[model samples]
Target: MANYKPDLSCQNKFISVNFSEQIQLGTFEYALYYIVENKLDLSGSYAWYDKTGAVTYPPSGMLKIILLGYAHGLISSRRIARLTKQVFTL
Candidate 1:
């Protein structure tokens, strides 16, 4: 099983969003998230990291973010970063 970042959706944060509710079924984001989480074979990605040092974000999560940015035509890394901040910000 892959180690994933903690799911903090229910935490009382400054900006809270129930992603499952926000992303409706049959949508592109929904499909992307589902496919990456369930269908992809990410075992190879785990080989790159040893059980030491700082824990990095999962490949599946990174892939989802990048693909979503590309789908929205945000090619620049800076733009994508900004977009993500805006998205999670209040």
Candidate 2:
């Protein structure tokens, strides 16, 4: 295993977010955007693909929050859901 985990440090009080002309947002939201933009492996997510038979894009808004939490190394499902609600809304 590598000696360090790079993602955990992302949860601290500060982080830098730079938006190009195509996108404009703060760090957390931007992080979510990044996570979504870099799509998940369709093969690995078997339940969604095989069991659900849902051959479509994952829920963008919800997935964005979950992905952002993961980017910050927050693995707790509840926390991810909570932050999703708190930070991003329709």
Question: Best candidate, lDDT-wise?
Answer: 1
Q: Write candidate 1's Cα lDDT for 11-82 as tens digits.
A: 655556666668789999999989988998988986776756665677777888899999999899889988
lDDT of 1: 0.78
Give candidate 2 misplaced runs (Cα > 4 Å). Answer: 1-58, 88-90
Quote each prediction's TM-score: 0.78, 0.36
For candidate 2, the C-alpha RMSD (Å) to the true structure equals 12.9
How far in Å is the alpha carbon of 25 misplaced in model 2?
8.2
List the lowest-lDDT window of 10 residues for candidate 2: 1-10
Tens-digit lDDT track for model 2 on 9-89?
234334343223335566566555665557554333424343333244344444665666787899999888787667423
lDDT by candidate, in order shown: 0.78, 0.51
